[model samples]
Target: MMISEVSEKFDIPQDTLRYYERIGLIPHVNRNKSKIRDYTEEDCRWVEFVKCMRSAGLPIEVLIEYVGLFQQGDETVEARKELLIEQRTQLKARMEDMKKTLERLDYKIARYETGIAQTEKILRRPET
Candidate 1:
């Protein structure tokens, strides 16, 4: 299929797809005589993977490095595993921080509710 088809299928913009290809996030796409990109199923799969990584908050630089390693054959398996492990660790730490922040917000919300209830009770009393 063509670039347009791939973009429509993946719900991604055509320009973004082109940018990804230019930046080496996805492998090189075959070109037709008119120099237009002709994407194959494999190319589409890579594009989908890239979209997933981006959605998961993976940095573009890390994706680029992954693509490079992927193109270099199977010898970089350990390095690739290490990269994923490091990212997982960072994500875990971020999740922990978010949990703490959420707890603080919940506490503040409960405190505000209590204050509002007390104020309502005071307002219901006979005026001085």
Candidate 2:
């Protein structure tokens, strides 16, 4: 697949895909005879993995490190596992914090809804 096709399929901007390739956040993509990127299935899978990690709030440096480990072959399996575990732990903490914030917002909104209902009811009452 061409770079544009991959970008469109993944809903990622073309330039960002280029940047990921440039920074080693994802593996190098093969180029065509004319020097245009020709992404293979494996390359597209790499792009998908990188996009998933990025969506989970993984840092660029960490992804670059993970890709670097991946490129080093089987010896880095344990390292890769540790990296993913650490990132997962961090993601979990962030999710918890976001959950708390969401709960607070829900509470505040419900309070506002109740207050508005009361105000509307009072306004609709017949004057003494």
Candidate 3:
């Protein structure tokens, strides 16, 4: 597929895709006769993987390292796995922090709701 199609399909912008290629975040994409990007299935898979990792908050440097290891052949399997495990651990900690923040926000909202209700009740009372 063309770069535009890949961009639409992946919900990523063309410039970001080109940046990814330039930064070695994804492997080199093949170009067609006219020098337009022709994304193969493997290339799309790399895009998907990188997108998922990025959404999960994996650092760009870590991903670049992982991709580098991937390009070095099968001998780097364990190293890649270790990198993924470390990222996963970081993601879990971040998730926990987010959960706590959400709970605090919920509590604050509830308290505000209660205060509003009490004020409304006082306002609605009959005046002498």
Candidate 4:
């Protein structure tokens, strides 16, 4: 498929896709006879993988390293797994932190609700 199709299909902007290719975030995409990008299935898979990793907050540097390892053939399999494991650990920690923050906000909101109810009750106590 063309670059525009890939961009639309992946819901990513064309410039971002170009940037990803330029930065080695995804492997170099093949160009057609006219020198335009022709995204193959493998290329699209890379795009999807990179997009998912990025959404999960994996750092660009880490991803670049992982992609580099990927290009180095089968000897780096364990190393890639280790990298993914490390990123997953970090993502889990971040999720835990976000969960705690949400709980705190909920607690604060409940307290405010209770306080407002009490105030309303006092105000309705017949003015004296």
Candidate 5:
């Protein structure tokens, strides 16, 4: 497929795709006879994977390095596994923290609700 197709399919901007290529986040894409970028299914998969990892808070530099390692073949398998494992651990910890924060927010919301209910009750009482 062409670059535009890739952008539309992945819901990513053209410049971002170019940036990914420029920054070594993805491998060099094949070019058509007209010198246009021709993305393959594998290329699309990589783009989607990179997008998912980035949205999950994985740093771009980390991804760039991961891609570099990934392109180096089987010798870097163990190192790549270690990197993914470490990121997963960190993401899990962050998710736990976010859960705690959500709990705190829920508590505050309930408190506000209780206060409003109490105020409504007092306002409805008979005048002295």
Candidate 6:
């Protein structure tokens, strides 16, 4: 598909797609005779993977390294597995921290809700 189609399908900006290709994040995209990017299924998959990893807070540098290793073929299979395992470990730690933060936010919101309910009760009481 064309860049615009890929951008729309992935909900990513066209410029960011270009940047990803330029940075070796998504690998080289094949260009058509018109000099326009023609993304294959594999290209789309890479884009999706990168977007997911980035959203999960994986560092760009780490992803670049992973992609480089991936391009090196079967000889780097063990290396790739190790890289993913390390990234998964770090991601789990971040998820734990985020869960704690979410709990704190929920606590604060519940407190405010309880306070509002109590105020409403008082306001409904008949004035002496």
List the candidates' TM-scores in order. 0.81, 0.98, 0.97, 0.90, 0.94, 0.96
Compared with the true structure, what per-residue lDDT tens digits does model 2 show for residues 1-128?
99999999999999999999999987889899999999999999999998899899999999999999999999999999999999999999999999999999999999999999999999999999
Give candidate 4 regions above 4 Å deviation.
Answer: 122-128
Q: Which lDDT values do the candidates have, in the order given?
A: 0.94, 0.95, 0.96, 0.96, 0.95, 0.96
Q: Give the count of colliding residue pairs in each prediction.
A: 0, 0, 0, 0, 0, 0
Comparison by TM-score, 4 against 5, better one: 5
Regions of candidate 3 where Cα sits further than 4 Å from its true position = none
Models, CA RMSD each: 2.3, 0.7, 0.7, 1.5, 1.2, 0.9
Tens-digit lDDT track of model 1 for 23-114: 99999999999999999999999999999988878899999999999899899998998998998888789889999999999999999999
Please report how far candidate 2 places residue 71 from its true position, in Å: 0.5
Across residues 34-112, which tens digit of lDDT does each residue of candidate 5 receive? 9999999899989999999999999998999999999999999999999999999999999999999999999999999
Ranking by lDDT: 6, 4, 3, 5, 2, 1
Residue 125's C-alpha lDDT in candidate 6?
A: 100
Give me the displacement of residue 112 in model 6, in angstroms. Answer: 0.9
Residue pair clashes in candidate 6: none
